[model samples]
Target: MAMAVPAQTIAGYDRFPWDAILLQTNSALMNNTDPNVWASQIISTLRSTAVTLPSVDLAHRLVSHLFWNHHSPIAWKLLDIAASLNLLPPLLLVALLSTRIVPMRKVYPQAYRLYLELVKQYVLMLQFRNNSPNYEMIMESIDNVLQLSQVYSHKVCEPGVALVEFVFSILWQLLEAILDDEGLLDHVPENKPRWLSRSHDMDIAEHDCINEMKTEQKEGMQRKNTMIAIEIIVQLLQNKMTSRLLCLVHRNMPSYWGSFNHQMQLIASKSSILKNLKHITADTLLSLMENIHGVVSCNTKSKLESNVVIPAGSQIAFGGQCEGSSWSSIWLPIDLILEDALDGGHVAALSAIEIITGMNV
Candidate 1:
């Protein structure tokens, strides 16, 4: 018979070098002269451990200091390393999503690019994990992004647009991954019509049986996760800030809008919980159009009457008049112009005008 090992000895064998590894990594991050080399070392160490040490807080603080002090590339490199380890602390994620980064995107585009890459890595890491302990952190980060969008709304700057776009992309990716993993894409078969007997009681019993089956399915863990994801998306859609951000994205980024629209259509068509998303999407688009009409109407009202003069040597003619010297030009009202532009198969023209006017249509 083999000798029995002491309980303390077995416990020691199971223990990892959490403190030693974290200390050495923190020291390397702090004192290493070359950021690239240190980043490589950090990545190697994290991969070897295969666990996110709570002591990664030291690395988090160091990255925050670098980010604030204008060494964002290095900061982002460190963040990438952390994200690969799935060690992004909740507080750090919230900090990165803060409103403070809005201006940085414009002033330091390269650093901003690095920041985006870091965020993408974090999202990928989250997606790879099935049971993410950082779910609450991710949710808080979403709220932080929403808050940043709200703050950016008040500013008259282009930087906010990039921030809003980034937020929308990240939120969509994270939620889509969660929804996909939870099997929200699985087709829910429609309840078959039962053969009705002459008696009404039979019909009632059949309906009751269908309802019970439906309830049982809805109560499963997968269904619960799917519902939670749908609820989160719906809540975001209802939020004025996030909704406005998405509307702006829809108006500006056609490629992104097309892909996002396709995803929304998939969700609406496939998932029972997201059936109302189609209606919400329509309402959001209508609201965005109205907002465009209001802004364009206000800005162009004064310019419309004064600037109606047709340029000299122009081929264009209004109301069947060709090349006349200042024939009393009839001005089209803003509503009619919008109706003609939006309803008369000239949506491309309206989008161009919105872009030119910088009204975020």
Candidate 2:
């Protein structure tokens, strides 16, 4: 808020050209001249990527402009220029900024360069290895914040207003970093392993907060690199980057799985994604029930070969054993009364009678 807006200008990295375009775009929006058209062209420019291109800088710039617009009115004008020139931001970058945790070395070397150069303080690299769906739910929360009435009532968060997407992206970063590296934020003990730390995440109440909240922005890459962390998290999940996240979450918070259990119930209730995932829910529930039952009853491991993600289109088998045609449960031993009880104590005569009749009831 302290920095005054500057004259519109163009800025570009070695690969992507965007700083100049953003200035033009913001000028159009602020001046109320063809804002919608400029917005449309910006999105179009991004979508029509020349797949032949070597780097993602232009794409980065176009999207970056969205966040830079409010602080730098000139950047907004530059975004319009990028749109007019058919330049695009990176899709992967947008996705990274969405909800998953990503490492800087893997996702954004350019940004990482800036982080290392401008930030003399050493930064730790940590991965919160729990790949649990709670992170996915966290993403859903972020999406909701973007669509809040005060922010946007549209069905989905759209591009045009860079600030809106930029803000939402920041929320995701806060969640990822807090979940992965809370120590950096001064909220958790720096000596503790990063995965053990956590911070308050974005919520419904915050979504409804006033515009002044924008004035309360945090310092440096914290704002810009928020989505990058999340996008990596998503990439890991999609690519099944399982272990790191698992170790981070489960090892630190064993009970975190308990929270995942609740997600099954929550998702099943009219959430379309959950509605279609009933089988996974059932299998997860079955496994938990079986695991707990075994530990309680036998006082040890289940020894049962049940897996978490069930094989496709298979039901939970009530009867054990792999009999192809027919299977039966072995009857339990029981003592019968009547004459047999008396005969056991007594009777050589009864034994002889049963031997002759071939009946041992």
Candidate 3:
């Protein structure tokens, strides 16, 4: 029945006492106050304060407490607010990635968008070429990405997933070469086609390596991280491009909505991207498909770890049953190709036939 005290009102007399604010917030949480009330209060306080915001370390600690204590929406929102003000700490963004505070559900688009905002800022700040300041954070992100891939293999739309298979593929080859050199494959991932294994054993054989070798290894990792970052940007660019095309088409030809997909398919078939792929080997194509399959297919052998932690005195009970869909029997591409063939698109049909026959080889 009591109204929540505004954080700005609380701080109006005082010069932004973060410790007191934290204590009050904890008390409010313990007393079972609505998360939104406290979140609004915090955001208002941060935005309207005349004094300096909390230091990077202090802000990270505050956000971590906020995240661990109650609902994640508040935590995610606070991070976004901090990021907009350019007050977000690198570690806080890293924590966001590790915790995945924003659930990867289509319904929670705003929360996920805020999550990406923080991630993009952190990524832009990273200079992957040199000895980066946020090396630990970078490595932590990579580890979390691998962990997430194993847990949510069927959820390809999860952030950083596009790079998962490619990164692992390279790591697998690197490990393989090292093992071959050392004459032992003693501790490897459980499955064959090692890149798709339930987990990877990344411990390299110790060697009396020169300083240059160590430097080279570090540079290699930096390059790998750079590639992953670039891929994330590329995916964003592709999405933007599709939206732009859709807008242009919708604006110019309102009646084209009926056959939009058909037109798009035709355009793609004749696109220079496909036509210029004259040197793509069957093995390369098969590997690319296999990588995609590995990403989107659920591996029964892998266990999904629970990241949910219930704080003390929190009576909140979490439970849910997900109705998993059955895997489709047909590949949609094959059906589309068949339709193209039947529709008398001779050139496109011939291209499809060549690709399929090459796959059979």
Q: Which is the leading candidate under TM-score? A: 1
How does each model score on lDDT?
Answer: 0.38, 0.30, 0.33
Clash-forming residue pairs, model 1: none
Q: Per-residue error at 221 for model 2, in Å?
A: 23
Ranking under lDDT, best-scoring first? 1, 3, 2
Clash number for model 1? 0
The residue pairs that clash in candidate 3, if any, are none
Top model by lDDT, which number? 1
User: Cα-based RMSD of the predictions, in order?
Assistant: 23.4, 27.9, 23.8
Q: Report the number of clashing residue pairs per model.
A: 0, 42, 0
For candidate 1, write residues 105-126 as lDDT tens digits: 3233333334333443332222
Q: State candidate 2's TM-score.
A: 0.25
**Residues 204-263 of candidate 2: C-alpha lDDT, one tens digit per residue:** 132122232333332223433333333332332222112222222222223433343333
Model 1 accuracy (lDDT, Cα): 0.38
Q: Which portions of model 2 show Cα errors greater than 4 Å?
A: 1-20, 32-36, 39-55, 68-90, 95-361
Candidate 1 matches the true fold with a TM-score of 0.30
Candidate 1 positional error at 142, Å = 12
Candidate 3 lDDT for residue 71: 32
On residues 1-361, what C-alpha lDDT tens digit does candidate 3 reach at each position? 1112334545344546566557656755466444446555654555544333323433555555664334344444444444433343443354433233222212222333343444444432221211234333333344454453343243322222212222322223323322322323333323332322322222223222223344655445333333333233333223322222222223222332223233223322332332333443333323332333223122211211333232222010011221112223321121111121233211121221112221100
